[model samples]
Target: MAAGAGALAPVPGVPSASLHEFPYPPQTRPRVSGGSPAGGVPPATDLVLGATAGCLACVLTNPLEVVKTRLQLQGELQPPGTYPRPYRGVLRALGAVCRADGLRGLQKGLAASLLYQGLMNGVRFYCYSHAEDAGWTRYPGGTVAAGAIAGAVGAFVGSPAYLVKTHLQAQTLSSVAVGHQHNHESISGAFESIYRQHGVAGLWRGVTGAVPRVAVGSAAQLATFASAKDWVCEHQWFREGSWAAVLAGGMVSGVAVAVTMTPFDVVSTRLYNQPVDADGTGKLYRGFLDCVLQISSKEGLLGLYKGIGAVYLRLGPHTVLSLFFWDELRKMVQHQQPPGP
Candidate 1:
């Protein structure tokens, strides 16, 4: 039977004409059809695994993010008082963080990152899958629309955690500076401090820029991924495996997101870290227009994309891992399902 099945399968070097059609033996079809139950793995399982992997990666790479943020936020555009650049690039930054604050420094905002990513990716994947299932996949712009909505919601839900994380990551420098003392040491500490000082509003300090950035970036990512996957599948570039589709899709998606959202990302980062007093008591960015004007006037047009390289660095691996792992997890779940509805 195995030998017969092999004979019917597509030749190893030949490209299949259609993706939906498989050149497999008739007997194998029954085995495959009988192995899995209806509905296969729950969408939530994919969410859980993707979210876990995403959060883990974020925690591991956060030191790079910290260095990137500091580099972008430098007031002088040069090292302060000849402190050996404070943090140069990824490796140098990691070394400095480890040297100064020990291993704990590398994990400065780990808790907040985990919490934020878990919520962000969890909702993102869940909503995206549901959108695909609900005939949204058939629409012309459905992928982008679904991704925009998912990202906007995720950004809002995860904003508070992000605020805490950014503040904690920034706190280390405050201690070293003269007459500048930071009290927050942990995620809870940062949250409490922000709430105590600025109430609920403080926790959402950067919502204006953040919302648009996430929406645009997410739309670009999903649209690019879907389009790329379709193209690759049509071209028979990597067999019929979902992992190959994901890899190709993720590369295009990462590049699209990074390029499209660069300006908004810079604005969002600054808005999040800016001193509230500088903009006024309650105004985070004095409206988006004013924020743009200020950044342009003070820092120049280049300032709008300050840390774009880091964005690529972080996003490349992030999107690749996310999409690839998501496909694999889905497959595993399908394989494990019982033989019933």
Candidate 2:
């Protein structure tokens, strides 16, 4: 009996612990820690880094963007008897612009591009970070939703700059190739000229298409980045480092943005480039829907995505480099933060 009673007592190292009857306080579980396991950059930091990268990218690629806009906008309505030339691709376009107009022509819209990209990226990164903090980062759906909202707002804010940039770029090609001349000498000049000609409405010429283009592209980018990061982090190969997360996130985001926004982008390009008569009655598109219908009617379904290949070529590298550089810059900023009391 004595041996049996001793055996019935609690074991030396084990306690018969239960929620209702535990004698001591509940044990605190050890937290898993190393890097920021949450896998998100801080909102303010993201904004700063994104803006910096966007501005830098604009400075580096403004020439290419100018050539692209020119190529996309070229066609009928130019002077009679002058054959309009089409560029083969980005490099070829660059070469042609350089040969014809020198390096200055490539930087035609530099100011507007800088302003537009800087503001757009700043808003995008800031909103993305804030949304993530508000619990959007937990799932792919939430990330996409947040990104779309951010992108829509950003597009609206950046539309004026976009309009100016496109006009400036178009003017460069038009003046040299078509003999059509405007009073605009710089981005500010273009804005003033447009305002002088058509009032506030002129600045928002293609906003109808821009909204959807930005929203869908941003949603796709954020969703892809978050989902890819999650997948990579789960795999044994990328579980150990943050660089892998950055690379995977950027690549996925680039592809998503390029694929989803191509059609809207084409419409936007055409809408911005179309000639407007003195009465503003020669508009090619009445609105976004009209633009799509007209393109499909006139140029077939493929017309709605005419410059998609070029768009992908431009956007993919831009997005990848922007995100990647932003990540690195953010990490550096975080590392420099002093410990709190």
Candidate 3:
């Protein structure tokens, strides 16, 4: 998914081919709508649609997100075999959380998850849609560039929510807890505590890690999806506008996103969840570069890919569902609109 960005379940399909065979859709071109310079759904509508899709996907995929967060933080800065691996694998991790915190524990950060997904994807989709409508996506690499910009903007906007979500998800009983425990009692409490302790700046902490994480994820996700759609159609594996094509594209996008985003995801999670000093600076890492250097040196390169399986598992279905819902919702809204005079 998009640095947790977007995700899709695996679909049965063939690989994509040359862009020459499948030109960009004409409808994707810019247009004047309601006397405003925009394309497709209005920016506001796109925001709502994206948020709705993201929230829906988050609900379904949050359990995996929780597990993935714990897995990533389990043995921070420690050698692989040196740490106690309480959560051995995905299923085992889930089982461990369930046993320790019960069924509700699996949904530890539901509120924060919804808040983050809705805000992040809303801004991401809105910005990307705006860029597309402005003709920025018409260039050779415009789509990826636009996607990255949109995702970075979205990540910045939603960093506070992500910060809270990470803390909440990692808030299991100390016995099985990994990383620093913020021990936030509730979402509101977490916000209050951080703000009271660190002021407004504290809320935006770790944004440095989040922006790139989502930018890379969104870029790869959108680009691959576009290409995969063409590939599926070129091979006659699925009709151009059919559901099968969408699923195939989503599956390919999911794989590309997971591979590209995992390392950033790990860094972002650490930056967000690590304990902060009296001045609100990260105790473990002074900044993004320092975090990377320390992680690579202390834990080795594989440390960067701590929770790849959980990331992919969460990403695949989340991307597919979020995109499917987003498009369907847009179509529905567009249909209900009155024709232009």
Q: Top TM-score: which candidate number? A: 3
- Candidate ranking (lDDT, best to worst): 3, 2, 1
What residue runs in model 2 are displaced by over 4 Å at the alpha carbon? 1-45, 76-84, 173-183, 225-256, 277-282
lDDT at residue 283 of model 2 (Cα atoms): 54
Quantify all predictions' global Cα lDDT against the true fold.
Answer: 0.58, 0.59, 0.79
Model 3 RMSD to the real structure?
4.2
lDDT of 3 by residue, 10-69 (tens): 111322233322212222544564743332467778789999989998898898888889
Off by over 4 Å in 1: 1-40, 43-47, 76-85, 89-96, 174-182, 226-253, 277-284
lDDT of 2 at 170: 67
The residue-by-residue lDDT of candidate 1 on 1-341, one tens digit each, is 00000011122223344322331111112123543214543446646865765675575557666655655565422223433356565666667667777778777777887787777777666565555545464466655676678777767777787767666666665433211124476778788878888788878888786777778887766555545545677787765555566466455556667677777776776677766663235343576667777767766777676656667566655665554455456567667776653
Candidate 1 lands at a TM-score of 0.74
When sorted by TM-score, best at the front, the candidate numbers are: 3, 1, 2
Supply candidate 2's per-residue lDDT for 61. Answer: 55
- Candidate 2 residue-wise lDDT, 1-341, digit = tens: 00000000111223223111111111221212432213334556666777776776567657657766665554432332344565556777778778767878788778888888877778776776575555544453554576677777777778888877777776644434521244468777788888888888878877776778788776665445444444555675464235555455445555556666767776776776666877554356677787778767665675555444456555544654564556567667757765432
Q: What is the lDDT of residue 330 in candidate 3?
A: 70
Task: Report the alpha-carbon TM-score of model 2 versus the true structure.
Answer: 0.73
